[model samples]
Target: MSSSTPNKVPSSPPASPFKLALCQTPVTLDKEENIAVARDYLMRAAAAGASLAVLPECFNCPYDTACFREYAEELPAVGFKPTEDHSSPSLKMLRQTAQETKMFIVGGSVPEIANDGNIYNSSLSVSPDGTVVAKHRKAHLFDIDVPGGIRFKESDVLSPGGSATAFFAPEIDCTVGVGICYDVRFPELAMLQARELGAKVLVFPGAFNMTTGPAHWELLLRGRALDNQVFVAACSPSRSEGGDGYTAWGHSMVVDPWGTVLASADEKPALVVTTIDLGRLDTVRKSIPTSQQRREDIYRLQSVP
Candidate 1:
């Protein structure tokens, strides 16, 4: 897909059919530099005519346990009010960039300092007006100890978020669900968004290491897309060589409602732009009718309050 200038004028009612961009960019040790790179990519995505752009998890800082505290900053209060100190560079830049580019931006997961002094892995969805439309903290902490394999625990430093998050995007005229890295492992989150909230797309800004990425990244994405019949988009950081810290499995991709990979990026820094056709979503759902076929009488999934 080609990049095009963003539409400046807002439609009284959002138009149907829009492009989505998955920015699989490289992360660096430098926080400010990472923010700059994210801004540049957003510009490129907007130029590509993407009505919405998504960043990978922890785009502004190194994804390490020790680095979380060092890089963590106070995010805007839950109501989208700016923090008094305005300490979070990532949040500030994201709001500004969304407004300037006039595009809905899924600001990827960041290490956020909550009011209670606990740190959380949080993501924010910003509107073209720069207002925060949705906020989600990672509900599932990535804590696994595979013997002879990678064992890292986010619960040691981060707090799990409480509720499922899905927000309506006026530009795309669809609801989008937000999730972090480990949250993708839980199908209930995506299910709730699709079944209850009527989300057409579930966006997960994840960072899967070499160990799990190759094994489960694509599998989980396809499963979610197929199960819910909703578009699934996962954005990951560009894979880097051996470093002192974690090595992400890059391969950012977008899967259509039919569980097909519409576009994918290799283990390199790049912008993946794809047009998400809602018409196709309807066609698939109508043909399959899985939503109607579900035997809710036999078994029902409950939601957490």
Candidate 2:
């Protein structure tokens, strides 16, 4: 395999010991109510000294594929003329909440209406000053069917994002990569962010269901962290039994560079907090030197520009 770096690699990783809050909130039918609860959790996280707060996938709406189109709202285009009316209720609330809390907010995956009129499962990262720093549409759409288990085809209604996303988090003095739901299944995305973009953390806002959650949730989190020697965090919606739509597997967690579970939440509405130490990242990289010792002459991974 050949690997390519479409963007310039960072010279070094960012500073460490940043506090992160994973808000595993309940997702109700009422979008407004859900946003309200998310806002409350963000405030609580900030008050508790977290500089970064992450929400679960589809936090403002039901995770049913059928509901994506209904909940889809226009997102402000990057560098577009006269800023469009930030009329999308979800976007408005997220922006305002980030500003009010004075914390970086990873507004989790929302059904977004793109300029091309397509819907995408997208995540947005907002700065403490309420500016959108980065946006990542789920690159790997969740499309799976397990016999007598579960079936979900996000591709039926949503389009996959074209590029990997990583942006600097001034609050934490580090770079973070944003991914949604199924995007966590692809290790290349994490590798690109950690190895190429110098991202110290990868935040995935996913809603894995009963079938895959119990089987691979923790395993995947730890695997990614160990492989990249970076912090990996997954924020999931709280489980809801007997719900009409998808039943989320809620065990939101954060893993360290050494593949240790720093903090994890049970299958309930919770605000899981953890401190990510950049020093550990440096220690791991120095001890193993896996990233620098790669056999590029034998095999390589190519990045898509």
What would the TM-scores of all predictions be?
A: 0.92, 0.93
In the range 107-174, model 1's lDDT, one tens digit per residue, is: 99889887889998989888888777788888999999877779999988988888888777766777
> Candidate 2: where are CA atoms >4 Å away?
1-16, 78-85
What is each predicted model's overall lDDT from 0 to 1? 0.85, 0.84
Off by over 4 Å in 1: 1-15, 78-85
The superposed Cα distance between candidate 1 and the true structure at residue 121, in angstroms, equals 0.4
Candidate 2, residues 1-305, lDDT tens digits: the string is: 11211234344564658789999999988889988998888888988889899999999899988889998888764322223447777777777877787888889888998878899988877777666777788888888999999988988998988888887776577788888878888998888887777788899999998999999999999999999999999999999998678999999999999999999999989999888887888898899889889999998877875
Lowest lDDT sum, 10 consecutive residues, model 1, at 1-10
